[model samples]
Target: MKPRSVRTSVTLAGGVAAVAVALAGCGDTKAGDTTSGSSKVTASPEAPGETGGSGNPTGKATPDTVPGHGKTGQTGGTAARCTAGELRAGWQRQPWSKDGHVFATLILTNRSGRPCTLAAGWATFGKGSSGRYQELRTTRAAMPGAGTTITLKPGTSAFEGVKYDATQGCPTIGGFGVKVHAGWNDVPGGSGPVVLCPDSFTAGTIQPTMNGVNFHS
Candidate 1:
């Protein structure tokens, strides 16, 4: 009976050892699977040109490159050309005389309540008397460079220079005036009983700057 008991005990111990070995193998396989999953997660990379989850470029928005875009006030956008009815005409004779010639500035003021644009273009001179108008021969000189469109706010003014040889004794004419053609508007600009040399009557192109006018020569 004692020998039988000893054999039984040995069999039981062997069975327990086999069970422990099986558990150890299972633990090692689970650990290896966990490690492989962690490596795959860490190694993944984002694709090129990806802007996070938003999908938009990561920078400031660009401004409009079109002409007259996002402007404000009188210069905000395309304005209507000034007309004779909306403008008040005036003149200022310059103090200094040069080379027997008289210089004067033809002034055009905006009388309308809104803003308007004026093109720098040809100006015509004429005599306004006896309820009749006669166009004077005007010599047009090219501007130093290209002239830009001028915008005038309400109650503002633009100017053009007038020059004539006073020494020639051509005529001391009353009701001398100028008609400036800008865009589709032909507006009268000037107040005169000005003495004009009709033969040498010359007008400069309308400009926003003095450089465009032949003030000196």
Candidate 2:
């Protein structure tokens, strides 16, 4: 097994970014996010100062069969299926984030000895507490080519670009979580709390994290 390398990243204002992990041999080894759906799910408006586990309309609850969980379109790869244990998760703030909209990338690395595949769909996730994405996050995909299975070789990585916003005078998030397989893993997002009122939040499709790829906003 390769040694787990420590990665570091630029901190967002207010220490929203916690103690970070760096990419080992990859460029900078920052955080990442994931997206899904054949088409994008528009976010619904929530009341101001509203806070609860009540996810967005397009968002699903945990233990998701949402899109890529068990669907043939999302997981038809011949490579060994990736389990939650074999992958490590992290998140990164997008360089283009601005104007109340916070974009991020979700990253999952294969730490096992063998190569495997990831479900080519929206990641099931939520913001609140560590490893407790009780609510599933929403995702939109680039269709006609979205469900192409992603193979993760040992030490390689996959990513999802997630979209969210921070409302002024709202609550703060404890952290974030996402599901690869088996169960939910933490994907720390500093996108603040409260999915209310004009706050849009949804992930983009899963893709191979290379050449500094990003899920477009």
Candidate 3:
């Protein structure tokens, strides 16, 4: 499991609220769009597009490559071929649904240094009803690389979301979220995924309800 970055995890619950506030801001509605501490925040709908960070997308490995620290190695079946870049970080979600399925959204960010790319792939694991742990699902997107140029400036990021729908013959999203130990095939080796929660999970905070507790399968 990635340690979690504040930028990504903290914003999970705000998704629906963001849209609500943005809608209420049309006329004389009070200033509800700004999230508590984020006084300058404005709400807007998220769009589907290629997401990532900036930097030397084609450079040496970064210092933050610790296990469960977000940047996974390319050995465990999943690979995101990041050439050489400055910084590569991602935001992910683990919120459960009404029907018992957990949804995940990975928002990749680049801090601009070199050009790089992330492959689309995923895996899931957790305990099963039989009291034994099992691999729920593993997937590889056909697209080779989601490339980004090194020219992007610092603080820029990208977003991508995929649902592990319950398919009889495929991996289900019911188990406790899997440890993101795999990387894109392009960067094969095996490392941990960078987590998206920042600060510690707290009551009423987005992290707690979104990722703090794990559901037993």
Candidate 4:
């Protein structure tokens, strides 16, 4: 892996080049809310005043449901079988720092007797009035195509991680929830899986530490 920098680029670890993963294996997001159709979900604002998880020690609020955990697409339910065997795909979000930095990893395992391709990207959102999104950030990978492609042996899994700087506006960190969408095409299987993880942006320290809540009128 390359050193973490602001420059937008995808550097493959095992000398792999320009292979975009076909992320269609996982389900897509719903039109309006990311949590639509999800089981009893909730959305909370940036720490402090909200009636949810108490604010981090610094007094910042902890966001409710993570951003990407919301619903995606109208067709709800477990994926249908389009292929012979079962293919597993999922991603996890790990908090790097409370100061708006995060890392994400994608995992794909092929149960069939062959290899597969995968693609993935992140969708960011913020809470607004009437339980809607107020802000969104869409990032295009610095690579040549949509995502990286990897071949997996039967019963074997592959892992990939991407580091990002989540400023106040970019909703990856300190914002809402995040989810991973992964899949393989030209192979037998159903739609991929979506794993949602909640994130806390306002959990960071105040300007000089102990920065109180920002109450607006």
Count of clashes, each model = 0, 21, 51, 33
**Clash number for candidate 2:** 21
* C-alpha lDDT (0 to 100) for residue 204 of candidate 1: 49
lDDT of 1 by residue, 59-132 (tens): 11222110111111132236776655555543434444444565444555566888876654434445554323
Quantify how close model 2 is to the true structure by its C-alpha RMSD in Å. Answer: 13.7
Ranking by TM-score: 2, 1, 4, 3
Name the lDDT of candidate 3. Answer: 0.23
lDDT of 4: 0.26
3 or 4, greater by lDDT: 4
Question: Model 2, stretches more than 4 Å misplaced?
Answer: 1-77, 137-139, 143-145, 186-199, 210-217
Candidate 2's residue-wise lDDT over 34-132, tens digit each? 222233354322211210111221222112111111111123446866766666664555544555455555566776788777644445444454444
**By summed lDDT, which 10 consecutive residues of candidate 4 come out lowest?**
3-12
Q: What TM-score, over all chains together, does every model reach?
A: 0.52, 0.57, 0.26, 0.29
- Residue 211 of model 2 has an lDDT of 25
Please name the candidate that would achieve the greatest lDDT relative to the true structure.
2
RMSD in Å for all candidates: 45.3, 13.7, 18.7, 18.0
Question: Candidate 2 vs candidate 4: which has greater lDDT?
Answer: 2
Clashing pairs in 1: none
